[model samples]
Structure formats: C-alpha cells, structure tokens
Target: EAGVTQSPTHLIKTRGQQVTLRCSPISGHTSVYWYQQALGLGLQFLLWYDEGEERNRGNFPPRFSGRQFPNYSSELNVNALELEDSALYLCASVPTGYSNQPQHFGDGTRLSIL
Candidate 1:
C-alpha cells in the first residue's frame, strides 16, 4: 500500500494571501489530520477530518480550515495568511474506527512567507 503523499513540497506566499495544501492519505485510511511545525512552536494540530467529516480543530483562528474528500484525500486552506503562518505543514492518517492505530505521516509542505 502507498503512503500519504503531499503536493508541491514547497509553497511561497505573501502576507494576507491565501494558500491551499493538499494531501492524499494511505489507501484504506479514512482519517486525515493537519499540523504546523514552526521554528519556535512545536508541532500544533491544525485540523482533523474523518470519513469526510471534520472531527476537530486546534487553537488556530477561523482562517485555518480543511476538508476530507470522499476518496479520503484532504486539503488544508489558509486564508489571510501571515508571516507567522510560514511553516512546515504536515499531514497524517490512520484507518477509520481504529483511532488507537499509529498515524503515518507524509512529507510536509514547506510554506514560506515573503
């Protein structure tokens, strides 16, 4: 089975702009999560989607949102982007109804703000 895949690998955006990051979870998985890893801050959970429904979100503002597709792929959208938003965005996945299973991570998408 294939692991999760992230697109672009790198993203450049200006302040106040919007950016969308994509992720495709492993086959047979139904849960997708988004996280941000910045220089100072440790890994912070951004969003969680299971079975095409948003399950939870972190302390981020409303501008941080995402959705899971029917095929189990996911998209993370950042609106009103800020310089602080520049970070490595990671996506992970585990099978549905199996929350205890370890989530496998994909290569993160590095976002840089100009």
Candidate 2:
C-alpha cells in the first residue's frame, strides 16, 4: 500500500502567524492523527480525526485544530504560531478496525518560526 503523504514539506513563519498543514491518509485508512516533534522532545500527539469528525485531541492549546474530510484526508491548523512551535509536524493514519496495527506516517512538514 502507498504511504501517507504531506504537502508543503517545509514552511517558514513568524510569531503570531497562522499556518495550515495537510495530510492524505493511505487508501482505506479512516483515522488520522497529528503530532509535533521538536528538538530533544519526542513526538507529541496533537489531534485525532475519524470519519470526518473531531474525536479527540492532546493537551495543546485551542489554537490547534483539524478535521477529517469525507474522503479520509485531514488537515492541521496552527494559529498564533510561536517559536516553540517550530518542529516537524507529522501525520499518521491507521485503519479504523485495526487499532492494534501500527500507524503509517508521512515524511512530515518542517515548520520553522522566524
């Protein structure tokens, strides 16, 4: 199967700016997750979307939001961007019925705050 794909592989922004990153899940996958990977810190879960609904989210601020499309693709939006938000934003997807299976990740979007 093909892997998940992310667009705009790299982004540069300044504090207070807003950005939107997109993700396309692998064919047949219905759940998508957004994560942040900064230096030193490992991957931190951000948001979860399933079947076009926002199901759950991590301990992030309200500035972070996302939604799943009917076709299963997803998007992650960051508002009031901060320097601390500069990191590799990753998107992963898993088949809805097989929670035990490992999620497949995209190459990730590197967001740099100026």
Per-residue error at 63 for model 1, in Å? Answer: 0.4
Per-residue alpha-carbon lDDT of candidate 1 for residues 1-114, written as tens digits (9 for 90 to 100): 888999879999999999999999999999998999999999999998999999889999999988888999999999999999989999999988365789899999999999
Considering summed lDDT, which 10 consecutive residues are worst modelled in model 1? 94-103
TM-score for each model: 0.96, 0.95
Q: What lDDT does each candidate get?
A: 0.92, 0.93
Query: How many clashing pairs does model 1 include?
Result: 0
- Give every collision pair in model 2: none
Candidate 1 matches the true fold with a TM-score of: 0.96
The RMSD of every model to the true structure, in order and in angstroms, is 1.0, 1.1
lDDT string, candidate 2, 6-97, tens digits? 98899999999999999999999999989999999999999988888887899999999988889999989999999999999999999893
